[model samples]
Target: MQDLAFRFLVQLEPENASNFVSLSNLHASSGRWDSVAELRTRMKKKGIRKMPGCSWINVNDEVHSFYVADKSHKCTDIIYTVLDSLLLMMKGEIDVPGLGCMK
Candidate 1:
């Protein structure tokens, strides 16, 4: 379905951010980092800006939303630190509870 949508979008417009991002994510998940980098670089050269990711959560009857790469938040440094640690840990052999060690 995504491939079909991507093809259709390509027919209409080949350089839109959403389609590029969707295809880039597909390539990234498949360990095609070179392709991802190429697409991003092409977008940069073409002056196409990718949309920032955003999500919302309800806390104490208030809805709070945050966007990716947003540095205005006070805990941004701490969040990035923990995220970096998790990425480093995941890069090594992980001991899964049921699946055992994954290379």
Candidate 2:
């Protein structure tokens, strides 16, 4: 199912802009930083500038907007910490025995 979805995503038009951006984000989430960089470069070459980074939070029926450069949100540190934890877990799982057993 995931494979089909991924293929469908990849088949999206190169001009969609968001498609490439989504692919880059997926790669980054899977620890493929180099692929993300390459995709970003491709997007730039195709004259598709990335949209400015922004986030929104809903609080008491109010939507608060936060930009990457905004000092009010520490998004960078939060993302780094999450990624660090994932990396540690991945390393530990890889070190486990019998998981990769080849009979």
Candidate 3:
């Protein structure tokens, strides 16, 4: 009951750190260390996340790296399919649940 209510408060105002802190306290009270940790990580990310200045990839066991807005990958069009989906999060238009995958 309290969990749902607290989570709903977070949903209502995701940008408000107080809601997240309340949720984290709830997790801590239950000894849900992992949930508390994940929430803390989310808070840090929500506050400090930034656009990538570079990216890397592995193909055929070879590593390749690229700079911001790179267009050098042979599969750039296909790779960008993944990138486009992630732009909203990168722009901080939405809360990120976990790190996104880039090609």
Candidate 4:
């Protein structure tokens, strides 16, 4: 995994933020906090910023895109409130491992 990522970074798209983020995620999943932090620090030093991941969905014939820490939507507050309620309900029903849940 590291070999392929390094190849992509060095040969294909060295300046791409996604490459850095993917490598950081690999490190983080392996309990390598220092490596993850180092990768992020490098990205910052190189002026490379990772774009937030987003999900697109269709509701009532309208399409909406949602991103982490997003505040541009008109219904951001209400959407968050509903999501919070759903998370709380899920907490009572089962343990969602690896997912950040309302505490």
- Model 1 residue runs over 4 Å out of place are 1-8, 57-64, 74-103
RMSD of each: 6.5, 10.2, 15.4, 6.8
| Span of 10 residues, lowest total lDDT, candidate 1 | 93-102
Q: Candidate 3 residues 2-81, lDDT tens each?
A: 88998998888888887888888999999999998998898898893334578677889999888787788787898788
Task: Locate the minimum summed-lDDT window of 10 residues in model 3.
Answer: 94-103
Q: Rate the local accuracy (lDDT) of all candidates.
A: 0.77, 0.71, 0.80, 0.81
1-103: candidate 1 lDDT, tens digit per residue: 7756765775578768887888788789889899889878977888888778998878799876779878776677987897787786677644435545455
Best by TM-score: 4
Model 2 lDDT-worst window of ten: 94-103
Q: TM-score of each candidate?
A: 0.51, 0.43, 0.45, 0.67
Give candidate 3 regions above 4 Å deviation. Answer: 48-103
Clashes of each: 0, 0, 0, 0
What does candidate 4's lDDT look like per residue over 1-103, in tens digits? 6847664783577679888888888888889899889888888888988888899999999999988888899998899898887887676764555665553
Give lDDT tens digits, candidate 2, residues 3-22: 34644765766666767777
